[model samples]
Target: MDNSAQAPLQTAEDPLFIGGVGLKSRLFLGTGKLGREELIPEIVAAAGVQVITVALRRVDLSDKSGNVLSHIPVHVQLLPNTSGARTAEEAVRIARLARACGTGNWIKIEVINDSVNLLPDGYGTAKATEILAKEGFVVLPYINPDLYVARDLVNAGAAAVMPLGAPIGSNRGLRTKEMIRILIEEIDLPIIVDAGLGVPSHACEAMEMGAAACLINTAIATASDPVHMAEAFGLAVAAGRAALLAGPGRSLVAGASASSPETGKLTAFLEANAASG
Candidate 1:
């Protein structure tokens, strides 16, 4: 099978390198909360996503028809996440299991015990990252937008730091924008804005703010039309990335700035005509 068709084409923008792998697409999709599992391939094709995250629990290898792995194309990189893990130990176990299942070495460390908020446990996450990274796993830990925790993850050898835009599955959209901005500026690793992105504009804003990528699942899955929403997100991500590369104009602090030059020939002519009149 020619799976090369499944890979997203590289754009004019530079590739996003993580764990020494160059990814063309900045939009990373998640295979959770989808109305139909069969839509995975279609969503990937629509979004042109190079990386797709899947919960370890969803991989049912025994049943080929139901297996999430079966639906995913070989060209796309699989990022198996430790979703149900509540502690560092459990997260390590899940990651190890994922690798054992031949899902590759890339793992998204998610240690969340809080059922109410569904927020990641930073301490546990860092610890797991440290362990998994040592074991040769490409670790991407999902965390709160905390500078200290990010620093810890860096020291722990994380390939990238994934901070939440808001509470998981809330679709609130970059509620922690300032904090994420801080991480982007401070952290040396790629800052992938994960969770709570409700719309294409939210993804665009994140990219404009210099986020390396955006991981969206719930918004696209629960939307009225998942495929269309995926394509919208894909375009939005590309546009935002291009805008960032283009070097957006600086914002004024108080007064509005005129688009036309203040001291140009046209301006002088207009001023003279007004004065003469």
Candidate 2:
């Protein structure tokens, strides 16, 4: 009657509950940089992503071609982001439009004012989260890894807090590792590390640091081979999560610790040999 043996195993379908919805996959892929829109579904399938993101904007009558929506499979949940919005009201408007288009109620509030860095405006994001959450939309706000902003977003009803490891699309790997670590420790909600993850190793590092999930775009989209790259990231995320669950060892500040028994010391062996000789 071992309880451990009887316990249910954590499978791939193990749900990550966010905004009251259970998501199967921790990797949330963004539909932005695939060479062709037709490649999206295939990439997502290769990545095994259960949640995907999309942007909202006015329909382009000039192109008169297939839209990005048609490429996305119906099984995945859509997380519409307010990427172009500069204010809370603008973000809310976009969210409303996205919902109206039947894209579901999940929204990623990305209110950016810094054009140079493409950094999210924490205040504007929190403001939008408050409004959208009140309107029954599950809000996931992207912000700098600032503890105060994270706290504010949590208070504003954010389903999860998305903190940047580096500037968006920089391909930098966890530049704000310390700050993100603090957020992971202090924030009650899921800490989804979005932006600045250049490689699979970077995503793995975030997961190893106990990040609940990661939102990667350029790293996968701009790779030499995006399809295979997506697959690598998927494996990296899972490996990192497993490493986190395995509980990493503590770091040594300066000194080295012996891994094996000191009793079988080489010095002792030498002394014995000399005495025998």
Candidate 3:
């Protein structure tokens, strides 16, 4: 029953906060390309996801059994995305329709005009985000890992900036890692790495690099065992987050560093023994 709209902005225990809601889980699961609609609840529970993204086109209000909304628990925050919209105008229209369906105000702006690459149009996304944000919707726009576009979204009143790790559903695993790192460093808002994550390691890498969150779909849904995959992703996300919080040691550029002391009594004893032999 706890939705983003009603949830508090911050809590003592919860660290990941988006759209005025504190989420314990950093992974956001997508409903599209799922193998079975019936596995939705189990997938969600297995992943321990607090937010699930559903395409507006996939929701059927009339067919109760087929409706994606029916399978989702009321407690989870619904992130209705404009997946099929090819233009800003079309995206805006879909967002309004999604709201009318009582799915909540969280909208993921996906304006992809490039049919070949399926990359989002940055200009159109910014326009739609500005329009929707003013309308009191929590706008999370998906874009190629571009610094300027991310800045534009921030100025346009976006809740968080979602930069794709690679092409949508490619499962390529952080091809744009450097650019995404720049966004995470410079952007004041939460930089959620979305799209093209292939495995649990990909999600883990994103979290390790200080990404506020990650949204994955194809990798989990198309796996041999979806429930187990979801669980793996959940554990991976948590482990990466904990590692980040624990402050991993700096990586050396050339020379290797030993875990134990290099110039200690043990090293001296070993050297003496070797010399005597």
Give the higher-lDDT candidate: 1 or 2.
Answer: 1
Greater-TM-score candidate between 1 and 3:
1
Q: Candidate 1, residues 30-149: lDDT per residue as tens digits?
A: 879885878888888888888999887754677756777788877888999999999999999999999998868999999999999999999999999999999999999999999999
Number of the top TM-score candidate: 1
Tell me how many clashing residue pairs each candidate has. 0, 0, 1
* Candidate 3 lDDT over residue span 109-184, tens digit each: 9999888999999999999999999999999999999999999999999999999999998999999999999999
Give one digit per residue, the lDDT tens place, for model 2 in 1-277: 1112211112344567897776656788877776676877777667777778889877788987767889887767789999899999999999999999986899999998779989899999999999999999999999999999999988999999999989988998999999999999999999999999999999999999989999999998888788788888888888888898888898885535566555456477777789677
lDDT of each: 0.90, 0.85, 0.87
Model 3 weakest lDDT span, ten residues long: 3-12
- On a 0 to 1 TM-score scale, where does candidate 3 land against the true structure? 0.85
